[model samples]
Target chain A: MKDKIRIASGSGFWGDLQSIPLQQVTKGQIDYLMMDFLAEVTMSIMQKQKKRNPAAGYAKDLIQIMKDILPHIAEKNIKVITNGGGANPMGCVEEIVKCAHKQGIKGLKIGVVTGDDILDSIDNLLKHGAGLDNMESGQKVTDVKERLISANVYFGARPIVEALKKGAQIIITGRTTDTSLTYAPMIHEFKWSWDDWDKLAAGVIAGHILECGGQSSGGNFLGDWRSVPDLAHIGFPIAEAYPNGEFVVTKHENTGGMVSVDTVSEQLMYEIGDPTNYITPECVADFTTINLEQQGKDRVRVFGIKGKPATDLYKVSMAYNDGYTAIGSLTYSWPDALEKAKKADEILRTRLSDLGLKFDEIRTEFLGVNACHGPLASEQNEINEVVLRVGVRSANHHDIEAFGKEIAPLILTGPPSVTGFAGGRPKANEVIAYWPALMPKKLVHPKVEIITT
Target chain B: MSKIKLIDIAHGRSGDKGDAANVGIVAYDDKGYEIIKKHLTTERVKKHFEGICFGKVERFEMPNICALNFLLHNTLGGGGTVSLKHDAQGKTLAAALLKMEIEI
Candidate 1:
């Protein structure tokens, strides 16, 4: 087994920096490149695209990225694991194959993990006594059965490890846990046992630290943000993982970002619910047991992570058509701008009320005044400019469209010195709501298939 | 003892899970952690965000990292795609929490 492996994170979310994968493969020595491209609601969007066109359900940016990083990664003998597959892994694999063949690269092996998409099987599962109740609200799935756009189960690192063991150069998956993309490589390289809870949990922690790309390395750093140098060319994080369940979080040599204990600690707490119970399919990692020490400049050593056995169920993410919404904004400038914006909001709401337009919710915010923190925002007197933003949600599409049409009229009749309205009348958008539920592990199976170019 | 804002000694990040939002606050040092641990209770946090967070507040401790995580339920309108609020995901909720004053 290899003594150590270097795994580099390329992308964090679906629309993350596109050029980082090439940079990671070229600017550094790395054994594997892991990219995460899925979010909570990405699958529903991809499903909509697939419904329009059968082969367009995946992260379309991956094809361009593969075209750019193919030769470099091939020359470096680096493997790639990503959940950019979204709603379709086979389609993503096919696109990569075409990109590689076009570039005259031969004999590339691509692995595809399937069976995460269960939209077709939902009715059957429900008939078989699967409650599939919403984890938060305890509501039945049948309530939104007709509106569901996408449903996929979250798989862990085992299928990915299987793909790596089968000599696959690149692996693509659907709805895989974000942490699994980083840890699967460690399990394959070191041949770690499945039941080694500490090692598995250590891998999970490394994945969490690296999953957000540059967050652990000073990108979204809150502590001493100005101390970080060269924000323009920030380097993504790399995990120098060892066989003993220890890893050092660092970036490339002479990179633009800083990797300190502070940066890593903040990321450790990002989006986490319970410090003692970070549940994944592989193990329940305890974030409270983690230990961090700054080893050198741009390097933080993470160790002593604890985890428990895996649960008997898988968390499934489903999205449905919640309703329609439209948001419009106009900026009022100078001389009691906040007052003018508040007046504009009142005029618009009064007009909507007079027109007898009904909506589920009507919300307005003065951007420069109290948009982000709402009640907690500090009182500011005489603000130079304020963006009057209004949004309405409704089950009726016509009411949303009607709300969109009233914003531009405010500049003409309601408020003076309003200028920032460049786009045409705001259009109604379908709001896709997320439904998280759990299912028995025996009901779903992950399949790994390999394709050669 | 002196009164100071929580931002003086701590920094954090916030994210959303369904309708609930979690703000993870990490202290600058162990001393700062102790100060926050004593003063930053769930009741105080709930009272601080009285109108915004309509549900109960739950706090989790991570003394190893000198951090505390606060999960504020029903804080994001309806959260995700349905929430019409500008900060639907509650990304800036941490800064709001750090604005709280504490006696140190």
Candidate 2:
């Protein structure tokens, strides 16, 4: 078994820094480059793209990054894994083959992991007694099946492990869990047992640390932001995994940003509801058992993670067309700016009410004051300026559009000293509402295929 | 001893799951964790975010890591791609949460 292997994170989500993958390959000696490009709602956007053009659902940016770093990774024998496959893994792999062929790189094998997408099978699954009820709202799938744009079950690392075993140099998946991309390499290299809960949990924690790219480093760090240096050149996180299930979280040698116990701890808590029951497909990791120590500068060793067997179900992320929403804002300057903004909001709401435009929801925020904290903001009488932002959501398109038109009128008729409306009228946008559900693992299966050009 | 903002003694990160916003508050030290455990109750946090969070606040304790996670249900207006707010994902909620004052 390999003593240790370094897995470097490139992108946290789609539209993350483009130069990040290049830096991971050029600046560091990593065995695997893991890029997570999918979010819970990204599949819906990709599905829309696929509806417009069947060959264009995947992350097009991944092809460009592969073009930039393909030759270097090929030379170093560094494998690549990503969930950028989105709605089309085959189409994404076809593009990557063309890129590699154009660059004269030979014998490169790419693995395509699919079958996570279940948009087409929603009706069949529903008929098969899979209610797919909303885990949060207790609503059935039939409630929004007509408007569903995307529905995909989140696959875990088993298919990825199979792909690695088949000698796939690059693995592209549809809706795999983000943590699996980093842990699959550890599972493959160390030959870790599938039932080894502690080792698997340790690997899961390592994946979580590196999953956010620079967040585990210092880019979005909230702890002593001033102390985190050179965010412009911030280094993405790297997990050096050992056979014993202990790993070191660090960044590139010359790159900026920190990898301390505090940073890792903060990331461990990001987006997680429960600390002990951090669930994945392979195992249920207990983050409370994790132990961290700052071994050296820009390096924190993590160990002692425990886990239980995974549940019998998989979480499914589905999105449907809810309604239309448009938001417009106007900045009111000093000399009772807060009061002026409040007055403007009242005027706009009164106009909407007069027009008899019914809306599902209408929200207003006074920036430079309580926009973030709401009632928790400390009162300030001497504020220089405040931006009055108003948004409306409704099933009627004309209502949201009319609300958009109301903002421009307010600049001239409602409040004085109003500016910062240079973006023109806020256009109505289709609201893609998320519906979280679960499906029995036996109902859906993942497929893995390794291809070489 | 002095009264200080939570940001002085603890660091936090917040993100959204559906319409719920979760803030994970990690103390800098054991004493800081004790201070947070005593003062930063679910009621206090819900009150601290009055008018923003419409649902109940559930706090989960992680004494192993000296952290407390607060899940404010139905807090993101609508959350994700549907929410028209600038901070739809509640990324800035953590910074706002740290503005709470506590005695040490």
Candidate 3:
């Protein structure tokens, strides 16, 4: 069995509150504190940052938060693990190492996981027969080969264990599965074997339970969302796990957010698919087998997890250049909101078609009228103003370039009272579409780098 | 050959006896239900489950969902303490059965 360590989660999304991580370590008993910071669009935004300044690609805010909680972390010797590494994990660690050294801390090793970003080698791999097709769209990688900003295959807990084995106090990785950030430390501390499926499943379950940071601890409880306590000061969750594959998901005493079966179930179902064979790089855990109950104040004990060997193939997330798309929106007022919106879209389409411009897709969505609920959306006849959002995508820059002319004309010609086009002409933007494919484990490897700034 | 199907219809739903990993098979509607039920009686499910488990398979029926929850035992061949752990990103038992086909 691996060493017994407590793993705690702090951040869920990029915009998560900052005070939570500090509170988690200060108030709870934990050996590792994890924070997640990447989302789909976050990659593109970071890519833009890297373009302007190569050192700016990782989550820079990690610097500020680490400063806030470092003393407590250092005092408690809490090992901090986070995917705030984004496209530049080494950059993140350098900042941490510099900060740690400033505080007169010696021998604090920070390890970084890299090689997930295979942007340059994409073409060579594609020529060798990596189709890297879109799982949702059924389009091949060749469809959008020129526009990809970032492509990272999610590495699970193995690199994390590798880091812990190196005796690092802090670990940062790029684009790992969110839960893997939590699972890796457990494996390292416990020294769990590769084929020991049940313990792996339990760790996976603990990661899932705490992956969303505060969600499991009560930040976004669906049952009477109004009734969840003190969300403003919500307590981030900590996994007090035992060597027996048993764990308690709880928060520091007297902290915000409620921990209950209902809240945990809601979080469990979020973005979830099959539970029985929940596949990860480590083991395939059966979420259905999880037995959770309130053990005491502010704690839910999870047990009865089942797992099997992991698959030989790893799911690779490849982003390719789809096409350039630009959206321009204009609003038309009350009496003829929908009608004017339709006119605006038709006028834009007509002008673009007249210009003989071609695109892979030219789409329009009525924001207030029926965009959210989609096909089953209700007709909002009473809406005072409707925003007409028209976007187009195409490999030909010239074709998508014509969209700039088509959208602005709608303000003066197509719809009366058509205003709200604040950003001037719509500039073409490269669409980074997701491509889910499989790669043999042998072909892909994760590299670790430690930089002291 | 039919394409194997998998779904986790019971995460925290009832018919979940403690100590068992509860999973509901879609059975692919009523017709599929008939076929799967034929092959997966509690005894048969237990037999199939036990062969892999070296443990136990506690079963429960949820006719409303038209599925069954099978709690697996000696899973991970004695809990997770034995192996390196990972986050199971969107995997389930039903997915396992869908991929793992055994002709009875």
Candidates' TM-scores?
0.99, 0.98, 0.74
- Model 3's alpha-carbon lDDT is 0.68
Better of 2 and 3 by TM-score: 2
Q: Residue A108 lDDT in model 2?
A: 94
Model-by-model DockQ, in order: 0.88, 0.75, 0.03
> For each of the candidates, what fraction of the native contacts does it recover?
0.84, 0.69, 0.00
Which docking category, incorrect, acceptable, medium or high, applies to candidate 1? high
The pairs that clash in candidate 2 are: none
List per-prediction Cα lDDT, in the order shown: 0.93, 0.91, 0.68
| TM-score for the A-chain in each candidate structure | 0.99, 0.98, 0.87
Over the stretch A164-240, how does candidate 2's per-residue lDDT look in tens digits? 99999999999999999999999999998999989999999988888888999987888998999888889999999
Every candidate's CA RMSD: 0.8, 1.3, 11.6
- For model 2, what is the alpha-carbon lDDT of residue A194? 94
Residue-level lDDT tens digits of model 1 in A1-453? 889999999999999999899999999799999999999999999999999999999999999999999999888899999999999899999999999999899999999999999999998987876668899999988899999999999999999999998999999999999999999999888888999999999999999998999998898888889999997889999999999999999999877989998999989988999889999999999999999999999989998988999998899999999889999999999898988898999999999999999999999988988999888888688788999889999999999998888989998998789898799899999999999999998888999999998
Error of 1 at A254 (Å): 1.8
Candidate 1, residue A209: the lDDT equals 94
Interface RMSD of candidate number 3:
15.5
